[model samples]
Target: MDNVSQITMFFLSGLNETNNHRFTLFFLTLLCYCVTLLVNISVIVTIIMDKNLHEPMYILLCTICMNGLYGTTGFYPKFLWDLLSPVHVISYSGCLVQALVMYSFACAELSILSVMAYDRYVAICRPLEYHSVMSKQRLIMLVCFSWITPFCINASNIFLTSRLKLCSQYLGRFFCVNWIIVKLACFPAQTTVNGIVADITVVIYTFHGIFIVLSYMYLIKTCANSIENRAKFMQTCVPHLTSLLTFLLTGLFSVLIMRFGSKDFPLTFKNFVSVECFVIPPLMNPLIYGFKLTRIRNRILVVLTFKTK
Candidate 1:
């Protein structure tokens, strides 16, 4: 509580331990970012260019990849620069924007995953009504819901955060987070509205998670008794499940660390935990789908073969 004010800048303390091996870390991080872009873009382009991948499942996957790109672009560019710089500072406005992008990206991801679960449910559980249920108009609306709702929800949080008088300018994590910004507020009472809104947001997304779980549970029970549904689940739903679990695990780790992590933990470990959500899912989702989903995998392979020939 040393220099209370409306902070104009924030010093990021996550990279404090990177001085000894900054260049090496920078190289690895750059490589990771490039690979992430390559895989996500590859999946997105493959789906768009192929006529057969015009189904709701592939379209939803494409949406997920797009979100991956949107989220990672917010973090990686700033982080790579910070890795090489002597002073790691971000303008207060820039910090808020990054936080907005990060949280909205996460929430949007869960929303999209919920959509995917429903898509699979309709496909496997109600094959006769799949087309009418997941029509182009409906698909468009679902995608918009996935993206827009989270943006609006987090935007409200950021709006509330922007009004706070900060007691600190140092963010311990590598990237900006809304909760961290809220924690920096000069007065506890001023954050009452923020706390209420944040809790409501959590409950909303928690319900999304529950909906997904229930959908998949029914999917499993229905698929269990039928050989055709079992094959379909293996072919299509597995990748969705993989992506969901990856996202959930990484996101859960980040939340747990942020809420109850030990300060005695190494900065390196904390930094890794902070970025795991951004790094792993973006890179893994497309790869999981590309390798596991038959249509996408075949499309990618055919394209590669044609280019090589």
Candidate 2:
């Protein structure tokens, strides 16, 4: 009845808090889910049908769109199930697979952003070499690494977790968060929390630090050098800034709550931030690029007005 010993069922209570909130959340999540699918599908279709967007940036956009596709789907399925079925039960195997796939996409998306950063880095920092650097073969290699590496990491993490015996009380976290589900398994480790911290730190440094530095470094230099550079810089930089600010603000709130606030505040805000990550990114990416990018706007307008009559 404690933390350890063989446990089967785990209960999660995020999206099912109150009747009114639950109904509101259900519709909200459903609306977000629909928008997520539509926006991403629109991007994917544009990339496929339009020969002009068969370029590297759009290619990465398509890949990120795929990750959003998986992420939004992974979250709502359980929420919908819980909305209908009061039990909200997930089998051990089901939890593992869900966690694996969820993290796979999460890590892949992170990697895609980093690779996209590098793409931007090369494009701006070394404009002459951008073509040679991110050639089709190289793009293929980057894409391969993004998907393959994360799949292995999360797959092993989930596999290790599956071996442990946990009580049925936890029922899995409200979401298919890999670390939470793994912790519930009660696998004996020297430092599970420290391991997660180290892993996240490494990820942040790898993707955010390097890119942010390189991005702004190139960004700064370009701005300083010429007025002609300003327009193109403004175009690409906006998406990065939008995503960056959104990510930083959400993460900042979570960190402040965890570090400075009381126990209740931390949990309350942490859950909010988790939803921000899950729901916001998919929605934001579309808005950021769709409105800002002229090509996407033109393509969208074209697609919307076409009747094939």
Candidate 3:
């Protein structure tokens, strides 16, 4: 047999159990993907067109929806195709690209959420200086940091994974993931650097999570002293908290599954766990923000009514 280094394609074994229901799954997945696009695009377009909604909060919400679209685009199309194809395979380069997109998308979400926390912190806890603190220039910089930092970090991780020679071409999951690819390294020693970098990436994002918590702690304490602040907290802060909890829980579950999931678990269950982050947050974030924010909700309703007429 030729060396595994010569292997240019990987077989995804995660779909093996679902062959009998491929068509049904394909329709359902396509429907979900369509809805994801519709909701995300609607929120994005509503924000873009409504000049009055161009404040920092709405802009950040728009960023979140844009990120939702960006992240889900990386997964849904390929997944829809794989659902119908008998051979679930991807080329080596394609696999790395997918890993880059998937990881960066997840990382960027946390980064953006951290920025949103800061935006909220300034708006509520220090209302007098909210505009100066979250100026247009600063918001642009923060958005760029959220997007670019994650891309670079994940790209580095994928580059390290790319240098290693593989001993296997069959990835058990439905999609390519950097950690899974790392597991296929020809030698255990080859992955020491990858593990170290992965740890650092984890630490960076872990601190992002910590910063969010502390920011909210201060937010809660500040809001406690006044009914006006309490009303503001319920109106603005709750949606961000909802989004943070949704993103964090779903992301954490996916990571846990990757790191500790049992092979004995049903493939169906494992597949759901792997994809819950992609599914829930993309679909829910826009809806949560849209209905929760009165301006967005009113504008969206106006747009819908205008369209209907």
Candidate 4:
């Protein structure tokens, strides 16, 4: 307990073995972060600048792009700096904030996707009620719900983490996460509440997964009967599915690796799995929505052509 009180920062050992390849990794990471910014921003800017995209679906797409920016920003800048420096360390407070941002960003994403599923369900299943169901007031509320609920949930976890006496000042991953911090607690009893809250959080998101699955099941069944509905499904729902799959598969791997990863596994491989969620989704979700959606694609083309002239 005295040692924990004296601790001021954590040493991130994830990058210790990469010293031999630091410059190459730095260049690559810098490029990835820049491209992530460019693509996500382009999608967000296109949607915001073009008033024709003021519909519910486009607004949600914009929100997704904005979130990609939020999540990546929380990690990339610190990571890029660590790549350049000899030491990989973060202050206790900074680590907590990063954990909060990363987890909240993830949970908020699933929440937004759930909302998107509802949007599609209304659009396809109850066309007449789509407008009434997704009115401006309602959309605003849903957006708030998506971001806020996760923030509060993760905030509670982080608050619990803040109270613990951490026996270790080292984290395996390049970035901090609540679970890793919880695992460092000096006493097992200290983590009981943390574990309970985490389980509840998992249950909450599991139900979100169930809701999305049920929504899409109905969507697929309905679309099967009508050619027009099938076309709409291809145009809109496919991109959502791609985004959802990318987010879920990457997140699943991260969780599995954290919980069950063998010590014999190469650090590089484990690091890659842990960071893949941050890398892939931010870069791909915008591109998927930008090119896959007709309005966004055409608007981007028009701007590019106008610039060329």
lDDT of 3 by residue, 81-108 (tens): 9998989999999999988988999999
Which residue runs does candidate 2 get wrong by more than 4 Å?
Answer: 1-8, 185-208, 251-261, 266-270
Q: lDDT for each of the candidates?
A: 0.93, 0.68, 0.91, 0.91
Q: What TM-score would every model get versus the actual structure?
A: 0.97, 0.85, 0.97, 0.97
lDDT of 3: 0.91
Model 2 scores worst on lDDT over the 10 consecutive residues at 1-10
Candidate 1 C-alpha lDDT tens digits along 100-179: 99999999999999999999999998999999999999999999999999999999999988888898999888889999
Model 2: per-residue Cα lDDT over 1-309, one tens digit each: 243335555566553444456667678778878888899899888888999988888888888787878877777778766766666567656666776776676567667777777787677768899889989999989988878888877776665565555534563236555556555544447336536754764575466546666677777687667675667678876676676566556545644643455656434345555556666777777778788878988998888888553
> What's the number of clashes in each of the models?
0, 8, 0, 0
**lDDT (tens digit, per residue) of candidate 4 on 195-255:** 9999999999999988998999999999999999999999999999999999999999988
User: Cα RMSD (Å) per model?
Assistant: 2.1, 3.6, 1.9, 1.4
lDDT of 2: 0.68
TM-score, structure 2 vs. true: 0.85
